[model samples]
Target chain A: MINVKQEIINSIKEITVGHDIQEFIEEVLLSDLGIDSIKYVELLVSIEEKCDVEFDESDLGADALKSLGDLINLVNKTLEQKVS
Target chain B: MKQYEVKNVPRYFEPHVNDCFANAYATVLSYMGNNPNFILTDYLNFMYDEQTEHIGINFFFRATPTVEFSEEELNSSLELAYLPATSMFNKTSPIDEVTDKDKVQINMYIHEDQDIAFTRLKERIDENKPVIVAVDLFYMHFHRAYQREHGLHAIIVTGYDEEKRTLKIIDKYKLSSSDFDGEISMDEMSQSRLSECPLNNPMVGEYKREIRNLWMEIDIDPDFKMNVERIYSIILESCKRMKGQREVLGHECGLNRMEAFRKDLLLKKESFMDRKLDERETYLFKTYYNSAFKSISRSRMRFKVFLEESNLAEKEDLGEVLEQLENALKRWDICANLSLKLGIKKSIKLVDDIVRQLSSIIDIEGEIINKLTDISLTRDLVTVSKNIKDQEM
Candidate 1:
């Protein structure tokens, strides 16, 4: 099985470009990821690809996701379920 | 046919693969060849600089709505749509309630010549077993460059010759007009070349067989603001009408207007007159229509700027620029909408609360680009660092 943390880390690295993820996650909202909404959707799609799952349109609701941790948590939960 | 030349017409590029124009182009191209499967992409490393070039061509045809389709979940992550045509080569997958096996596909095809292609289509469609070929309109924008200035636009691809430097178009400019045909030289393409073309005439024949979508722009300037103004006025007027009705209804029942209005909404009585609001869905209707108008305005401006500044001779970076601008606009748009929604629904103050949210959109756009650049730079740095370490070893 693919390492879930490693997969998440790689995906985050791909988007973060070279910026310290630790800093971004701690300091920035998920919306500040420096990409457009389309890219954000792409990131979600990428996450789905990396984790092997799908995200629904409902996940895009305003209050649905508040921070990077929330998003990562959501991805982790989905990944865990997929693994199970 | 009158040979019209376009001087300094505007051009546009989709910032990403989901661009409306690219999707529309791809659909049309797919319809032509009877291939319903196409993947639109704007992730090309090359960028087409659109600010300085003008493409000129004349077209004669009309546009009809086409249905979009997607591949099934796994192996088919791509969404495809059929372009309007009279006949198709391949039978479309059965849609619910569409049981006609003899149904002519409404996709069109582009060919070496417009007159020949269109005549062939008309004749084939007349045979009742319509061929599933669609017309290509990628060249129509060039042919109809003049008409765009007048806000008269049509989409159809008739024909082209890279050697002869000519293109023919079929467009639907007037309601009464049928297939209008015309052509233009490739001089405009030469002028509007971006800074990143790896090959000469990279855009040439890109839409011949199939064109993928990369991004969509909704022009949101004067026209958009006006649309918002109009909708707000109408909705506000409706609110006033409701307020007045509430006052009357409440007076009759000895209740406050708000209370009466709320009660009337709750109580289904025959006394409720047919209000224009019967067709209204406040959030759904308002948001969608407003979004469309905004898109139109912003798209038009972007197109204008792109055409005005493009150069055809440079190894233009057509793809990257388009994607960048698209990223900028879309992110800003989302932030703007979110801010408005928060203000309206959450009663957030417009100044401190909303501006901060709205401004973040631009920041996000800037940062994303910066981040990408940063990532690229860091990758280079790492490569150099690895190279130096290897040399030392």
Candidate 2:
């Protein structure tokens, strides 16, 4: 029931200043947007704080989140485990 | 508008996102050789620099955004200070390493007229040669920094579509295996080139160069060998610089700079205590954190590969150095990750832990230098000091 997609968009909106919020589609590759590794970490931390989901070290490795869909999937999986 | 492209312009795989100039240079060389072996690691490119400026809120702590080697240090090197050259662009690269006599030489085309540069770029492409172009992505809509972040990034322009007014480009610097091999309108590319993009990076400190219509071309011999030995010399040169970090070019160098960095971070504990860093502060810390990680961890890995590639693989201390480097390399990653996390969390404990890690890295680097020096001396390798004397003579 948690709107993880909206939450992720909201985190992105929080980081993005000056520009109006563009629609961030799920299949969009984060790299295409030029999100470097450090910025990616900030985004992860922002999402963790907002969604109350902690990303494990395995999830934080360079290969972890490829696309917005992948991040959403990871967060949803973590959220699922939290309820269980 | 018309359409033209240099076919098979290569892409660089080892780009660390911020290293566009290096990537563009390598791509040109790789395209020249048409060899996968030419795609080498940038282990030789690292340099040491520490800032004299201090963090604003806490003037006691140095702003020290330079945990990694970058172009700023490259530009600061005394030998190449003969910049402000007879051209519209003053950017220099390590093309000398790969400058094969009668085989390869990098040439720059610059003009007071932006159209001249554009015409030159088109000429090279028409001749089936890819052109390396400098552009400020802020003015270019095809880039993420469009009207957002202002900085100069080198891109390889392969083709021009006259009717569509587009240019096919290869901008491979991306986040983790991501790349761009596509088209941008000529208007977009021209605008990017013409805009005066003051280098906005904290490390490079406001390099306000004319980005207008400057492009580079390299004439290559079909039988050119990839300069792997240049990498070997550069590797040794980098180590010698580390050994001589105390030689006083300016502010603190090598481990001494690291110590200052540690003390600063530790001192920032009270100011940064449990406070989430604002986005502006986060960006600065992020630059330092990411740069340090790439410069140390990735460079060491490539150095290990170099040892394996060279005759040094037979040496007794080879395995020892490799194993120790591997261990230290992991710690650099861990430290960098902690630093990244610290940007958000702002914890004092993390600062202490990073300092501990820094101390370990410094010790390891010192030992590695000693070991590498012994190896280089035994191998009769030419060192950086020798290179300087040779240059002077």
Q: Can you give the TM-score per candidate against the true fold?
A: 0.23, 0.68
TM-score winner among the candidates? Answer: 2
Candidate models: Cα lDDT each: 0.33, 0.61
* B127-236: candidate 1 lDDT, tens digit per residue: 32222222223233433323222121223333445457664433323211223446644443222211111111211211211211111111111211112222223222
Query: Highest lDDT, which number?
Result: 2
Per residue, candidate 2 scores C-alpha lDDT tens digits across B1-393 of 567878777677663322566577668877876432223333222233334323210011223222122333333322111122224433354432334432345555566576667776787788888888878778766666779777667789899887888889898865323267888887887788777665555434555666546676766555565454554564466565565443332433445555666677677665777676656556545556645565567556656665666554436877787777777777777676777776666544667767788788778877777787677665554556678789999
The DockQ scores of all candidates, in the order shown, are: 0.02, 0.36
Q: Worst 10-residue stretch by lDDT in candidate 1 chain B?
A: B53-62
In Å, residue B41's CA in model 2 sits off its true spot by 5.8
iRMSD, model 1, in Å:
9.8
